[model samples]
Target: MATTAITRFAHEEIKPKIGSRILNSKEELLAGDLGPQIRELLEQSGVLVFPKIDFNDDEQIAFTKTLGTFAPEMQDGTNHKIHKITLDVKENPQSAEYLKGSLYWHIDGTMNDTPILASLLSCKVKATWGGNTGFCNTYAAYDALSDEQKAEYEKLRVIHSVWATVFYYEPEPSLAKIQGMQRIGENELPLVWNHKSGRKSLVLGCTAHRVLDVTPMRSAEILVGLREWATQEEFSYSHDWSVGDLVIWDNTGTMHRAEAYDPTCNRMMHRTKLQGEEPFE
Candidate 1:
């Protein structure tokens, strides 16, 4: 029988339950064939932070590909493998307006059955004040639930709508704007996602418009309560960025939101992703 090799990189836990810091050089991370180990770490830790690794666009893209399929970002009717994450219209014109939704807690690709597998963000410019990204480990949150709560939630379903997210920032949207966002569509997902790996996670987020077969008021209460519980200090991590820092989170098992900040303060991030491997089931 062959024995598996032990992982060699240095690591530090960011929190007891949710996050970790990878203490390895950019060169080693980019060159080492550590995808399996890294993916396992991501599943276990939920979030990984690389302090001041300073990877540029090409390097970031290369690093993303090392893990799995590279998910390209669509901009200006073109596919750009690396996306510039900024609220500045000059830098990311097409995506800037849509990014307002990032201010609220949400999972990416809620409109699709399968969201991106993971997101890798490298800091280009740190915010002048309050731009730390917040993440919550849904897996940890679900695991922390009481047996009765888990059993009850496991049977519920939710309606996740792209248009609903628009209302978070724009309470009263114009008919045309509503129609446009509606065209992007919505998906009905389980309140609890049962992963192929046998772990479970909550699928609640801002995009979760309502719980099906439940009263509107009840839906609101349930969703809001679950979100609050999941985001409590124990299961969440808020990253204070330093220029050149990189952060990665498992999109399938976590909810993330951008902390409020000055859009014009020139806070910038470069983002890359791994294509989704499992659909929400």
Candidate 2:
């Protein structure tokens, strides 16, 4: 099969002078056909950018559902809607702190058993400077590793928890909210997740605390070393946002983070999550 497909969609309707109209018109953008080319690119690139989308929370929520299912089913029998990661200076002040860490380099839903298949974030209010998102291809990162390292890593496992971060914000997070955080529903993560495609990526990041099969000290050293390696300048890209930008990354094989920005300035965003069905084995 052919590998490495790349497709990008952009619109001039999302510039400073004429962006507000698009956010109000989310259904059209959400319903547009993304075509097979974009799907293949998503598989190959681990990230996709829909720049200058004229989409709002309702519309962005609509678009994310088209990508995948709502992630992390709650225990209550009611499915949490796909729009789980909403951000606002007005509504969720306490959460805004933990979100500041979102500006760091990491992946989504590491705490879940299957994890989130993907996460889509839409910018409603853009900061004037330094609020771009950076994405890295974990599949590509693994492919670039030395053979010996890959061989050694194939046997390792690590512990990941949303509690580590959630408790950092709301010590007693809501049961449903905690369930979303704890999908994949495990106490740990394998250091190497072999995708159905057979590509493997390192599970090293801030949420990945330590190796399960190794000593804590050794695990820390290994995870940190590998994280530093994969995130090297060569394997990543940074995306600057204009108002109404929406970006999605595969949580299974990519790590993402927001760049620091003027938080005091308006920086509103609405995030939608995709529930994972199959586990990567």
Candidate 3:
């Protein structure tokens, strides 16, 4: 095992609001002292980009464990910890349709009682056209709101479901089609998540369906307004990935989406998730 002192590594802010780029080598990332620094930085900066880190499945899994507990159940059936992120039917026939939901803005595991803590994605093959991952800092968005707006939002709750996210890709999806897809059932989550760190983040995303105690139209209005507010350019970063680039984002405080790409572009990414320690309150 390698050990590198934290003082030796440097990181630069990628954007004023959301992202930080680690100015260190892949070997330094695997070092013992780096994970705590990375986790602390991740909490402050919503996303961290390790340009061209090129971590393999085993190396990615090892790094993930350093930050927090590895989510073993997040893996696909191949007995490997990495889940291949691609649109190719042959590579992921059973789950390709569900993966299309990634094209929309969402926090991972919204329907789960406890959503994922964080996600690590390493780009293996870059698409010819577009496959950039976009991240928005919901924490910043929430904090920027007027006190009155915050008060109103904090009183609200929203329902999340797999069907809501799937419908983002397929508008007017048939009931049968939605039932056929993987349904995690619906969960009612607070519109504003007050984390253990004493920070609050807006939990609005595509998976979010409607706000409680409001008419359907009013709920739609609130959800849409919050989504727009959270995803404004200043509070978000779009990462144009190169092969070997590895990125991790604080899933609890951010929403992410993949840019549109041709289905045949052969873009591939390997992903590993960190299990959540806190539930949405």
Candidate 4:
């Protein structure tokens, strides 16, 4: 049970012995410093894409529970209080319009009280070519900026909501529909977050609708610019999924999105999120 950031073994050795044997034999994954190292790595890098893991739903859920409370995907149910995505999302396009937003680069569940902390995604089906999941290291992006840029961002706070942007171009949103969004605004989160490791990161993305205490038009210009600046290729990594691969990212420090895939072919992936405590203080 090697630990303390041991390099993953060669895939030849790993890819072959990746069944219940490895799952049962591996202590580091179960109860060792590998857990903490993975935790630290996620906070440091904002993204962790291990090569592959032969994990079942029960095993995946079990592993995720080790980190913190699990946030199940929101399903569309009449009485469901929290957002729990229904099975029909991927099955039917008309019902999955909300998920279409995921095709664009954005943070997840930022409109809620606990802005989803971490996301654990398991790839069950692979697209022929496209469908890569892209992750932007906001921590790295913030650090690479000039001190002047950092200073400028520190003074900003953005408003977030679920539906305003979802229906942005719509001229006349129905009154009931607008109210149904359950839009909660006026959240004063910092644009620059200083992590415990002395690293700083940007926290801007699509859900961030407006700047607090700033003019609406200028705020849009600034936010659009910042998003463009932070997501440059050098600070980003794209994960092309193989069956059984699991990727995790710190939602507090990174933004992510799914690339366009041919929905005609079977494409199924399950995502579990960790609840965010504070938007990096």
Candidate 5:
């Protein structure tokens, strides 16, 4: 929305409500002052796409540091900070099982005290059929709700757990597996997150288990209805991946998921995350 020299490089309003494509070169994106501008744009546009930016692990890490605190890859023992996202057990044996949970829409790190600020993902290998990533703008979704709906949802609190997402992928798991997922714990989050900027966004995603103090059937009905409303085509974007494409989205204000693909398709993405500054109050 704001115009400047960078406006020439910023091709925004890509969709009705969500994405902006940055046409700048790597040099411009790495410039000292561009970080704040990019962050500002990210707030206005929930998703930003860099076509064929092709940033390696170190370059991606450097870019992430410019935006906010860099969240390193802690699972694998590799020295590199970027985490490879793939379904291939050979590449990410230990973590691939957890990635299956990503098939359902979720806000990253909901189990943590503070959720992640943003996520930067670069496409490495493209899948043959499906692997498109979809993003829904919660801010826009919240703004579209009726006054009665807003007032009702505003007072609700949600119980979120990693198990909520995992169950979507595995409806019936062994008792041991269920217990393992529960160990990740749960947190009570406001159904609507009122940001410091005074903008509010709905926090409905697969990680959301249920509405606290509500009947089970009522909670399911509300959650299912909200998820459908928030993810309608008008408020969402589905990105078809191309090799070397890079995408970054505001994790706090958006919910995202990968479109189902064959496990053998060989799709891989390198990801880096920016640490969050606010809690889900």
Candidate 6:
């Protein structure tokens, strides 16, 4: 397995194939011209953990821009770079219900042709129990597939829909709720994303509604089977959160899910995203 080559900051690999922990002071990270180095490290290690760096919203936004284009969270005509990650209706009324689907393994922005490059999530209120974010390196997973498996998968396509994700969390939903999710739409994407960087990653996730040109049973078998394979312990990492912890993961190369936690705990996180530079092909 390729190892992370980040020499500027004192760092340790979290796992052989997936994560890296950066041991650097918050000031150095913000003041230095480390964008290129950090980006390289991010690609090498799909997930980067900054233990208790404790960045507030302004600092997080500033840090996000240093790395790449900052994707502001545009909601209800309000443009804000920091998004509140929470399930509490009173705190995040707009996305509380939607976040329930986050419990399942999935990639974000599957409906969009180009998903965000990376997401920076800093914990503000840690969960009392559970709620460790789980991540799987899809790029590593794809590389480990047998040549025969890779060859066969390369020819397949998938239909991904937001409504499918809703159904996973809300088995029996009202027609109105279904209509809302349906309006977010579905996208047809290749089973294997042939990235510009010449690396391939599996696009399987909960949003993967069905495999095109395959029987329903076969599609289920393929999707579920691949998800299991990609998430094997060797290629996955589950991060335990602290109040000041911040994490960034390559959205284009990883599949992630939220571990179960108390709904009323009010675990909060502030997030910022980097705009995607390439489309999933």
Root-mean-square deviation per candidate: 2.5, 7.9, 2.5, 6.2, 3.4, 4.4
Candidate 5: regions farther than 4 A off: 1-9, 76-80
Model 4 RMSD vs true structure: 6.2
Which pairs of residues collide in candidate 5?
A: none
Write one digit per residue (lDDT tens) for candidate 5, span 149-170: 9999999999998876767888
- Give the alpha-carbon lDDT of every model: 0.93, 0.65, 0.88, 0.65, 0.88, 0.92
TM-score of 6: 0.96
Off by over 4 Å in 4: 1-28, 31-33, 72-95, 167-179, 182-188, 196-198, 264-266, 277-280
- Residues 143-245, candidate 4, lDDT per residue (tens digit)? 7778887788788877766665566435477887667665444355667766655667787776677888878898988888888877787677777889888
- For each candidate in turn, the TM-score is 0.96, 0.75, 0.94, 0.77, 0.94, 0.96
lDDT of 1: 0.93
Q: Compared with the true structure, what per-residue lDDT tens digits does model 1 show for residues 1-281?
A: 99966557778999999999998788878885677778899999999999999998988899899899999988778898888899999998888989999999999998888889999999998899999999999999999999999999999999999888888899888999999989998899999999999999999899999999999999999999999999999999999999999999999999999999998897899999999999999
In angstroms, the error of model 2 at 166 is 8.6
Which of candidates 2 and 5 reaches a greater lDDT? 5
Whole-structure CA lDDT of model 5:
0.88
lDDT of 2 by residue, 160-275 (tens): 76545565436677887777756634456678888777667767666776687678788878977877877777677777877767776677887888777776776766677777
User: For residue 237, what is the lDDT in candidate 4?
Assistant: 72
